[model samples]
Target: MVTVQEQGDTVVFTVEGWHKLWAMRSELRIPRTHILGARRDPEASKAWGIRAPGTHIPGLLKAGTFYFDNTGDNKPTFLDVQHRENTVVIDLADEEYNRLIIEVADPDEVVALFGPAAAT
Candidate 1:
């Protein structure tokens, strides 16, 4: 399952896959995917200095930095570093990234699937 926690100024989201692979360990190995970032307000995007070519998977996995502005006017602009990247650049602000995170079984699962040191 995916768990979200807020500690001070940082938000922690984790995906777990313990139960997801219980039945199909042979057919499916852990899946590696990108986690996207998003916000409800346009101003938030601007506040965070988020432009085009948004945050990617590799960067997120390596550095843990994600694009997040604010959903309100004069939102706090900052780069959230939650993970790092490897190969591809998956914009976290895009809908596709949200979809992937939603479909994942757990937040820890996502880390297991895409963490920078997973392959190594």
Candidate 2:
């Protein structure tokens, strides 16, 4: 699981446990302005076409970077989700990752951080 913490103008995502190895990094900091919105999307990583530099264990785990080949845009995604049911898709702009599909202990709290206008 991951923990979301808002610090000033940035939002941090802390990857916990062995997920740190799977994701290749322990923390990610994105400027609050770069966060377009967020939503609870269990199937957010369902169509991830390739695991470029990440790890996946079928229905068990999907951590690291993935690309959406079907979209042509090849939208890059960073995923650290163990359970689909507790995933949140956070859309971003002008950032390294186009989106983040991660599992948080309380999805509601994370979504609320972006506010109603930012929740799609």
Candidate 3:
């Protein structure tokens, strides 16, 4: 399970999962980075057009929460994205799963990163 907590200006993400553990054991480091102009599920609510935290996909802004299949088994992974006061929250539940958190200055940056036709 992923848990997100806020401490002053920083956002904390707590991730826990078997796959995450195995991956970290193999690599000794978690892969984290910002992704830009990535695709989103059509069925997703809120349209998630803003750049949010992600891995591999560059230019993607780290906004709200996101979830993906980390085990390559086609099963859904758990994630949480929330906003508290001036802070944004991201939480993952799986130690082996890769997670990224992006901190941007304002909404304009989010739009610039994840807006349609934005570069990857």
Candidate 3: lDDT of 12?
42
Report the lDDT tens digits of candidate 1 across residue range 1-120: 234444444434443343223211111112123233321221111123332332323322111112344233322212222221211221232222221122222334444433422110
Candidate 3 is scored at a TM of 0.23
Off by over 4 Å in 2: 70-72, 116-120
Superposition-based RMSD of candidate 3 using all C-alpha atoms, in angstroms? 12.8
Record all residue pairs in model 2 with backbone atoms less than 3 Å apart, i.e. clashing.
none
Greater lDDT among 1 and 3 belongs to 3
What are the per-model numbers of colliding residue pairs?
A: 32, 0, 25
Give the candidate number with the greatest lDDT: 2
Candidate 3 lDDT by residue in tens digits, 1-120 = 233344444334444343233222211232222212322221222223222232222222123234443334332322222221112212223443323332222423333333432221
Across 20-102, the per-residue lDDT of candidate 2 in tens digits comes to: 99888799999999888788889876765678798998889999988876544556789999989999988888888888889
Report the candidate with higher lDDT, 2 versus 3: 2
| lDDT, residue 31, model 2 | 97
TM-score of each: 0.21, 0.91, 0.23
